[model samples]
Target: MEARPRVAGIVLAAGKSTRMGRPKQLLPFRGRTVLECVVDNALASRLHRVVVVLGHEAEAVMPLLGHRCVTTVVNPLYGEGQSSSLKAGLGAMTEETDAALFLLGDQPLVTADTINLLIAAFADFPSPIVIPTFEGHRGNPVLFSRETFPRIEALSGDRGARGLFREYGDDIRSIDVRTPAILFDLDTEEDYLRLLREFPAV
Candidate 1:
């Protein structure tokens, strides 16, 4: 029998949230912090391991994850931008990890089912990148194959891995998902309110 790929889930929660004027990762959502919800989803998924990269208000956030089954890492260069946090998370991956599914801390609504869908696609297609699409629009957390790690590691500033899609267009696999949560990442107070209104219970 073929061995299953070891995929890790990396939650990027190191952003300073300058736009929201607060750490969105610590925001309350469904009885837990936004980051907690996102991390919980990742923990429930099929990924072999989970790593959460924290920065900005890491002191306050670290306490919340003390009991969870995740390896947390701090990104001192978080002020640099999303790329730094992305790199921080990637640095925690083990040698056997075949791919990484990058998730956003403020995107608490991205369910385990959505992440599992991406993993399933990678299992079959083994594409350079696996992205989720909602009604033809692409969204995160995107799956990056180990082959693209070097290019991703070379990234800098606030840029995420999306830029690589253009260069690897032929090797990208887009999976259509049923939920719009893939596109509803929280960025401001208005976004938070909207999320509460839509998912008051969970």
Candidate 2:
């Protein structure tokens, strides 16, 4: 029997959160920091390993992650953009990893089921890139096969794997999911409050 492809969950939690006037990763959500919730969801998924990228307020965020069972990497170039954090996470992935699922730190509402759905799709379809959508709108926590790692590593600045979506359009697999959690990311106070109102139980 063929072995299952290994996939790692790369939580991008290194953003500075300038708009929110604080580190969004440290925001309180469901009795935990936003990043903690995101990491918890990743841990509950079918991923083989979970790597969290931290920046901005790394010292403060470090405490929140003390007891977690995930690997953490500090991106010194985090001020450069999201891609820096992506690179940091990728650097932490083991050589055996077959794919990576990039989860946003501020998207605490994204459920483990949604992540498992993407993992399952990657296993069946084996697309170079797999993403989730809701009601025709694309969402976060996109997965990229190992074959695309070089291209992702070539990216710079604020651009991320999404920058290559058009180039790999034909090979991309877009799975439609039931919840809009994929579309929600906390960038401002209003966004955080709205998420709390909408996903109180999360």
Candidate 3:
């Protein structure tokens, strides 16, 4: 019998958040910082492991994750871009990892259900890429098969996971989802306010 693939979750929390000013990872949402919420949610998922990459204000942001069940690593090259954080997170994963789910630290609303849903799909129909989409719009927390990690590591600049979708072409897969939370990320003051106004109950 084929052994089950070990999937890991990688949270990119190292951005400078130049648009939001200060560190959005430390911003509060639902009684917790955005990084804490995101990491907690990822930890609640069925992934084999969860790794959080931090930079910028890593000192302030990391302690928030101290209580959570996650492995936090600081990306010294975080100033370069999201790709660097992605690389840093992947490096922290174990050799047995079969795929990695790349998540945003600012997207606290992306629930564990969504992460597990993607993992389930990838388990049943393994692919080079598994992206969550709302209606026709693509969203964050893309799952990359271990085969693509090398390609992703080679990526440079601020561009993150999305660019590889176009590069891989036919290898990409999609899991059509119902929630817009997959698209929500705290990138600015207005974005944070919108998150408050949009999902007040959560």
Off by over 4 Å in 3: 1-3
**What lDDT does the true structure give each of the candidates?**
0.92, 0.90, 0.88
TM-score of 3: 0.96
Superior candidate under TM-score, 1 versus 2? 1
**With candidate 2 superimposed using the best TM-score fit, by how many Å does residue 177's alpha carbon deviate from the native?**
0.2
Model 3 lDDT per residue over 103-159, tens place: 988899999999999999999989999999999899988999999999988989998
Cand. 1 TM to true fold = 0.98
Which pairs of residues collide in model 2? none
> Whole-model lDDT for model 3 versus the true structure?
0.88
Question: CA shift at 8, candidate 2, in angstroms?
Answer: 0.1
Best by lDDT: 1
Can you rank all candidates by TM-score, best first?
Answer: 1, 2, 3
User: For each candidate, what TM-score against the reference?
Assistant: 0.98, 0.97, 0.96
Best by TM-score: 1
TM-score computed on alpha carbons, candidate 2: 0.97
lDDT leaderboard ranking: 1, 2, 3
Candidate 2 per-residue lDDT, tens place, 1-202, comes to: 7788899999988888889998888877789888889999899989999998988889999888889889989999998988888888889987899999999888888889999999999998799999999999999989999998888898999998899899898999999999988998988899988978877862
